[model samples]
Every structure is written in C-alpha cells, then in structure tokens.
Target: MSRLYLGIDGGQSSTKALIAKESGRIIGHGRAGPCNHVRTCQGRAKFFEAVSGSVNAACNQAGIDASTVTFAAVCLGFSGGPEDKEAHSRELIRSTKYKITHDAEIALSGATAGQPGIITIAGTGSMVFGRNAAKKTARAGGWGYVFGDEGGAFDLTRRALRAALQFEEGWGRPTVLRAVLLESTGARDANDLLHRFYTP
Candidate 1:
C-alpha cells in the first residue's frame, strides 16, 4: 500500500481538499462549502458537512475508501482560528500526524515558499501574517466580521449600506450608491435591505 497525504483549505467561502502520494503527485482534488463557524449547533453541523464533504469527495476521486484509509499526514488550514476545531477534525480524520492551523499561515507559506516574509489576505475577512529570520512569527487583524475585519468584504458592504441608509433618511448628501444598491438587492429602500440582511 502506498502512503497517502491530505491537505485541506477550509475558508469562510469554501473548503478544498487535495490528496497526494508520498512522491508529491496529486491524485485527487475536491471542493465544498464553508466551515468557519462552530459555536452553535447549526454552525457545527455546517462545519461537519463542509469538512466531510470535501474529504470524502477527494477520497472517492482517488479511488480510496475513506473509512479504511489512514493517511500518513494531514494538514487543515481554516479561515477562523483553529483552537475550537482541532478536536472536531480529529474525530473525522485518521492520520499519523496532523498540522491544524489558521489559513493565513498556510497562505504565507505558499506565497513566500517557506521564506521569511509577510503576506496579507483580504477575502471575506482580512489579516496579515509574517515570519522573520529568527523564526519568530506575528499576526494582526483577523478579528472576524463583528468586531474587526476592516477593509474586508463584509466591512465594505456594511459601509455601502450605511451610506445608502444615510441618503434615504435625508441625513446625508445624496449619491447614486443608494439607487445602485437598491436595484442590485431588489430592496425598496436601505431599511428594507438592512432587514433582509438580518433575516437569515
């Protein structure tokens, strides 16, 4: 039997899995929905779905039975911090070794090819991470959608909505953003759009 390895990138938008051989030849790839939340029952369900869906898909593509195969190593990089997710992952994957970490670390490793440098990721959220020659590392600004995540997609959308609300309420200068947002979202006004955002 050949030794197999697995790598998964679990992000806010989606999750991807790759299965490779000991020789670094990629044998399979799969993709599924997001798995960034695990604080609630519904969130944990979604997390399980995303991780299992992607891993099973990859195993199938590689012509391997996931239940019977123990990977030599597995690495999963998640969009949110990995503190709450390690145990959940352990229950699902059988691996000799595991490297569970935040998405930014993997992104920096890939971007710099394991060199000492910095990388900024701006997707659903925003964060910056770096490593120095001394092997020290530092990170900033991955506080998520509620508190931080400045310059992220959610932040930009919030700013646009706030502007539209101000315009509709006659408290701020008029701009075409109000009309554009309303047309794009099919909202009668900024207030309606805001309500829709809160509705699931």
Candidate 2:
C-alpha cells in the first residue's frame, strides 16, 4: 500500500492543496475558491463547499481515493481564530485522518522548516509573524480589514474610496484616482455621482 501526505493552505479567496508522496516529493496540487472560517460572517455551508471542493480536486489530481489515504495530514490557515479552526478541524477529522492547524502555521513550518525565525507575509492581506530562538511564536498583525489589517487590500480600497469622496466635496486636491473613478463611473456631476457610487 502507498501513503500520501496532503497540505492545505486555506485563504480568503482560495484553498491550495499539495499532495506529496511519503518520500516528500510533490505529486499533485489543486486549488478551489475561498475557505474562510464559516463563523466569521459567512456560514458553514459556504466554508464546507470550498474545503470539500479543494480536497476532492486534490485527491482526484493525485488519482487516489479519499478512503485510500493512509497517512494524511492537512494544514488549514483560515480567517477566523481558534474557535473556527477547531470546528473546521473536527469536520476534517470526521471525514479523514488529516491533521489540521492554522494556514499560517503551515507557512511558518515551511518557511523556517522547523527552525526559528521571523516571517512577514504581504499578499492581498498582510501579517507579521516571528518565532523566537526558543520556538515561542508571536504575531504582530492580521486583524482583517474591518478592525485591523491596515494597508491590506481591503484597507487600501477603503482609503481610496475615502479619498475619492474627499476630493469630490472640494475638501481635498484632485488626483488621478478621482478622475479615473469619475470617468469610469460616467458621473458628469455630483448629482450623477450619487447614483454611481456602489451600483456595481
């Protein structure tokens, strides 16, 4: 019998699964859309669909049956914190013998490869993580866009909207973004602009 190892990196917009042989060689990789925690504004059904799709795609790519996975492990880096993680992990365990943890932990494990170091991740979102020489770990940021995650994509988008509005009210100087936004929205004047904001 053959064994397979699975690694999952769950994100807000997508989930990536890496299937590797017992010898540590990657055999297949698969991806599906958004696997954020179900408890954080989104419900369980959406979360489950995303995860199941990713896992099934991965298994199919590896040409292995879900039941044939002998020594499977999964790492989930989802948006919500411990509570959400526990629930998702439970779901995975009920279905398979995969180990589960935050997606960041898997990234750290890969970056440091079991060593100790600091890692800064800046993608659609941003987060700073550090592991001390003694292996004590800490995270500096990653609060999501609503409360934290300053300079993140959502944060940047919010800032852009604010800037656009400020310029429109003559409270700020005109900028390229303002012109671009007005042109794109086809707003000839403020009266027209009111209707253009957020129609899409």
Candidate 3:
C-alpha cells in the first residue's frame, strides 16, 4: 500500500491541510476556519473542528474517505508558537508519528527551502523572523493583538478609524479616509462612529 501523509498549517485566521503520497507529491488540499483557541470549551472545539474538517476535506478532495486514508506521518504547524496546545493536537489526530510546532517555523522553512534567510509575514498580524546560516534563529513582533503586530491590517484599520474620527472632531487634518470609512460603514456622521465602535 502506498502510504499517505498529512500536513496541517493552523493559524488564528484559518487552517490549511495538504495530503501527499510517500513520494512527496501533493494529492489533495483543503482549508477551514480559524483554529486559535480563544475561550474555554468553545475555543478548543473550534480548533478541533478546524483540524478535523480540514483533514477530512483534503481526503475527500482526493476522492477518499478520511477513515480509509491511513497516514504514515502527520505534522502540524500551528500559530501561537510553542504554546499552540498539545492536548488539542492529540485529539485532532491519532497518528503515532506526528509532530507539532509554530506556524512560523514552517513558513520560514518554505520561504527559504530549509536554507538560511529572513521572512516578514504581514497579514491579519505581522511578524519578522529569521534563521542564520549557522542555524541560529530570532524573531520580532508577534506580541499579541495589542502591543505588537505594528504593521498588520487590523492595526491599520483601527488607526484609520481613529484618524477619521479625529478629523471629524477637528482634532486632526482632513483626509479622504474619513469619507471613505464613513461611506463604507454607512455612518451618518463622525460622532456616530464613536457609538458604533463602542456600542458593546
């Protein structure tokens, strides 16, 4: 029997799974929702659901049932680095030959093809990580949703919103972003943003 392998990349925003043969040829791929453990049971359940759903989807894409596909090895590169959670991993897969690590580890490996190089990831969050020729590694950013991720989309959006509000209140210079944001959100005026943004 030609064995199959599974590789998962789970992150705060989404999860991806790939199935390949022993020869390293990718046969199937799938995607699922965010797997980040956010709150108690719900968090864990979401993570597990993403993992299982991704794996099964990949299997289905390859025209096989997940139960019939025996994996020789399973590797999970997940977000949140070393604190991704081992218990959830155990519940996600039943493979003995399995390993789990931070999502950035795989990102770096793929970006450099196991060679030495630097990689800066900018998405929902932003991070800079690198590996030297001698195998030394270092990282900057990934400092949670608040203090870090300086150049991420979420941060930029919030800043734009703030800028718009400030401009409307005559505290900042006028800019087109204010109009664009208001038009997009359908806010009647700048004062309405305050209530909408903080209504919760």
Candidate 4:
C-alpha cells in the first residue's frame, strides 16, 4: 500500500482537506464550513463538523475508508491558533505523525515553498508572518476581529457599517454607502442592520 498524507486548512470562513501520495501527487480535495472557534459549545460543534466533514469527503474521493485509514502524516493549520485545537483534532484523525499549527505559518510555508520568507494574509481576518534566513520567526496582527485585524474583510465591513450608522444619525455627510449597505443586507436602515448583526 502507498503512504498517504493529509493536509487541512481550517480558516474563519471554511475548512479544506487535501489528500496526497508519497510522491506528492494530489489525489483528492474537499471543503466545508468554518472551524476557527472552539471555545463555546456551538463553536466546538462547528469545529468538529467542519474538520470531520472535509476530511471524510476527501477520504471518500481518494477511495479510502475514512474510519479505517491511517495517514502516514497529517498537518492541520487553523485560523484561531492551534493550541486549543490539537486535542480535538487528534480525536478525529488517525495519523502516525501530526502537526497542528497556526494558519499563518502554513500560509507562509506555502507561499514561499518552505523557504525563509514573509507572507501577509487578509481573509476574514488579517495577519503577517515571517521567517528569517537565520530561522527566527515573527508575526503581527491577528488579534481577532475586535481589537485588530486591520486589513481583514470583517474590519472593512465594520468600518462600512460605522459610516452608514454615522450617516443615518445625521452626524456625517450623506454617502451612497448607506444606501448600498442597506440594499445588500436587506436592512430597512443602518440601525436595523446593526441590530441584526448583533443578534446573530
């Protein structure tokens, strides 16, 4: 039997799984919903669903029995740091060697092909990670959606909403952003949209 490897990227927006052979040929791929948070009960459930669903789907595509197959090696990169997720991943995956790491590290590795370099990721969240030729590493941003994430999608949306809110209160100049936001979100007004966002 050929040795199989698994690579997973669990991000704020989605989870993706890829199955490859020892010769570095990709055989299967799968995607599922987000698995960034695992603190709350709902978050844990979402994590489990996303990881298992994507891995299983990939296994099926690779013509392997998910429950019985043991990967030679498995690496999982998660958006919200990997410290809190390693144990949960171990429960769901069967592998001889496992690497659970931050999503930024994997992004950097992929972008530079394992060479010493820097990478900036701006998905639902934003972060910059770099590895020096001396093997030192550094990172910035990725402070979640509230305090940081300056160039992220969520941050941009928050700024747009704030502008609309200000316009609605008559404290700011009139702009087409207000109308566009309301139309896109199907909100009656900026205040209504804010309420909806806070509700869910």
After aligning candidate 3 to the native by TM-score, how far in Å is the CA of 145 from where it should be?
Answer: 0.9
Which portions of model 4 show Cα errors greater than 4 Å?
A: none
Question: Candidate 1: which stretches are off by over 4 Å?
Answer: none
lDDT of 4 by residue, 1-200 (tens): 89999999999999999999999999889899998679854988999999999999999899989999999999999987885798899899999999999899988898888889989999999999999998899999987887789989999998888887888889987878889988988989767888888885
- Candidate 1 lDDT over 1-200, as tens digits, reads 78999999988888999999999999989889987778854888888899999999999999999888899999999987786888999889999999999998988888888899999988888999999988799999998898888998889988888887788888978878889988998998667888889997
Worst 10-residue lDDT window for candidate 2 reads: 92-101
Better of 1 and 4 by TM-score: 4
Those runs of model 3 whose alpha carbons end farther than 4 Å from true positions after fitting are: 38-41, 68-70, 190-200
Best by lDDT: 4
Q: Candidates' lDDT values, in order?
A: 0.89, 0.68, 0.80, 0.90
TM-score of model 1 relative to the true fold?
Answer: 0.94
Q: Tell me the deviation in Å of residue 42 in model 4.
A: 1.4
Report the Cα lDDT for residue 33, model 3. 90
**Best-performing candidate as measured by TM-score:** 4
**How far off is residue 122 in model 2, in Å?**
2.1
Candidate 2, lDDT over the whole model: 0.68
Clash pairs for candidate 3? none
